[model samples]
Target: MRQRHKPWADEFLQENTHLIIPDPSNYKNKWHEVFENNNPIHVEIGTGKGQFIAGMAKQFPSINFIGIELAKSVIVSAAEKVQESEHANIRLINENAENLLDMFMTDEISTIYLNFSDPWPKNRHEKRRLTFHSFLKRYENVLKPDGELILKTDNRGLFEYSLVSFSNYGMTLQEVSLDLHALNDPENIMTEYEEKFSAKGQQIYRCKAVFPNQK
Candidate 1:
């Protein structure tokens, strides 16, 4: 049920071939080397289509962005965005969220973006959700001390579950907003998912949680 077009889709895919890392194991810890000056890496999970990550790469010139998506079709589309931009700071990987920890080394990641992630609604399937405690633990491994996880979702159930999951993991959570649009913060860039949810009048929840620094 996800829309495939982003207006500039075809142009973006032409030059982004290099951004797609084929062998995650080879450069597990050196992801920053792909960019100039080893810039800090920021990852966007579930990068549907590509507009969100593409627009972000254009906006945040300082940080290197990588969009990880499981769907080959969408990842190809996402890859095209980085390719079209021809920006060295952005990349795309076609991988599931569960494989995140296995692909990246500890303290190698700087920030994570979970934009409108799949909110597996069934109670029993909650563990499969990205914000589950186990997933947070994996995220903590890859994240740098003081690394931040930013999550956005229109599903109230998932948002509430995320809050509890984050808190139980000892992460310091802040900037909690049930209605993201009211804040009007520049950091809160609109993704394809955000735009759709907002149009539907669903309350988009957002939060930033940080990992503890290494002693």
Candidate 2:
């Protein structure tokens, strides 16, 4: 589902500017300072409409959360949601995941979340998938020694590909769910896509990829 362009997107973002960092790269290695505490930091890539991260922030008030969305128009929506809820533990960033390393230092992040990312079904476009090996390697570099990535999507192909990618990258598969909703896990927080697809009777796939301790 494509998002409709909003002429007032920029203005909305500006009004909620406190939610977003104007230049995240400048805060590299200083994210803890940004949050003003030593609590672990978690980030969500492709944070469409801010459902999961916002929920996470409310659920775990001790941890700091950052929501990254590439599109300005789309991020405006996330910012608005956070602002409305007055969630002080959440921050928004309008940036591409490709530049993730530039904005965050090695071992700076405790966890990363990829929720309902584009499957990029074409084989030629596999590298662009969020769960692809290339992205997994990048994630491993930025994440702490014991950090993990949790991915959830409705696309079976992407989930299968991610399982293989994480294995090939030498990461540990901590947990997996072929049908997330069926498990009835009380701890599971539904993303915008997860709620929509699952309500329609679609099965959701989820997995946690963890970096092994360096021996």
Candidate 3:
């Protein structure tokens, strides 16, 4: 079973002001209304500290962004920053990624970001990893047919495991890069975790898994 977050997790959930939930039970629709007249709706799981989500929202004013995290304390800081930044195209929510099916409708999400998700490295704990096959099934339910799941991590083993899992799921991998920081391309935006891990000389693995037929 998934252990609950520390106490007072609900307190910060209450403080998340910018979170736009038309209906928590139907999280898939209307999220794209905030931008582009109709921009793509992207979501980030485990948006810890909110740096990545906040920065991306600013960088891509055209795309709608959602930062979904379970921990309230960690999310409160991000919520406060969104308030201070006056970002209208982004939102932060306190919720587990596992219940995504209950939260979103089919074909709702355009992209998913899984940056530095828990590795769950032990053998018995492997099923808990965000990239596990079971989690991928949940993701497929909410993501659109052409939606892509972007994952970034510094754990070598977990990255390799994810690649195999995606292959097994018949998802196509594109723009797969082993080290994002080394790429001098402007297309690469440095997430907060990516910067910190790179500073410590750790390699980052990134991949985009696309679901062609599944919604």
Candidate 4:
């Protein structure tokens, strides 16, 4: 089901424009300058409503976090969450994942997160999956040497597909878990969808992969 467009979406985004990098592409190779610090950067693509990234920013104050979402309507929810508190380490970007290369130079990012991304369940739509190798190539270009890509999803099929895709890309896989909540990682921070799905007894899948840039 598609989400209905909220009437206030545009207004909300405009009002909170300071929290977003209006010309992210211009900051290519200069992300740390934008944040005004040299802290390691962690990014979350499709950061719906921002809970996970916000929690992470609170948990790790020394790390800079960026949350990217394409839809103005969807991203407004995330902007609202940031506005509710003081989070200097976090910022939101309204942009598409496909255009990430335009906004970041090679080896600019330290970590990438793909949490409950759209499955795009049809075989013909495989390229649209965030875990697709094509997307992984983009991520690899932005990630610093040995940078990590962490993923969490409730869709078993997507999880399975991502596992094979990451393997085929020759990434070193680690921390693979078919049931994330069961692992009981004390540091685990739940995303909005994760909380709802877990309440319904759904098993969440998660994994970490490192891009071996030299190998």
Whole-model lDDT values for every prediction: 0.81, 0.88, 0.79, 0.90
What TM-score does candidate 2 get on C-alpha atoms? Answer: 0.96
User: lDDT of model 2 at residue 161?
Assistant: 87
TM-score of 4: 0.96
Q: Pick by lDDT: which candidate is best?
A: 4
Which residue pairs clash in candidate 3? Answer: none
Clashes of each: 5, 0, 0, 0
lDDT of 4: 0.90
lDDT of 4 at 144: 91
Q: Rank candidates, lDDT, best first.
A: 4, 2, 1, 3
Backbone clash pairs for candidate 2 read none
Per-residue alpha-carbon lDDT of model 4 for 1-215, expressed as tens digits? 47678998877777776787787898888878878999999999999988898899899999999999998887888887877758899889999999999988988899999999999999999999999989999999999998999999999999999999999999999889989988889889999999999999999999999977672
Candidate 2 per-residue C-alpha lDDT over 45-103 given as tens digits, one digit per residue, 9 for 90 to 100: 99989878888888999999999999987898888778777778999899999999899
What is the TM-score of each predicted model, taking all chains together? 0.89, 0.96, 0.87, 0.96
Candidate 1, residues 6-97: lDDT per residue as tens digits?
55533444444477676666778877666646778888888887887888888888888888887666777667566788766777877788
Model 3 per-residue lDDT at 195: 86
Question: Global lDDT for candidate 1?
Answer: 0.81
Worst 10 contiguous positions by lDDT, candidate 4 = 9-18
* Per-residue alpha-carbon lDDT of candidate 3 for residues 1-215, written as tens digits (9 for 90 to 100): 24446576565565454363434554445455544357778889988877888778888888888888776667766677676767678876677888788777788888999999999889999889999999999889898898889999998999999999999988899878888777775766666677888999999888888865944
List per-candidate RMSD values in Å.
3.5, 1.3, 3.3, 1.2
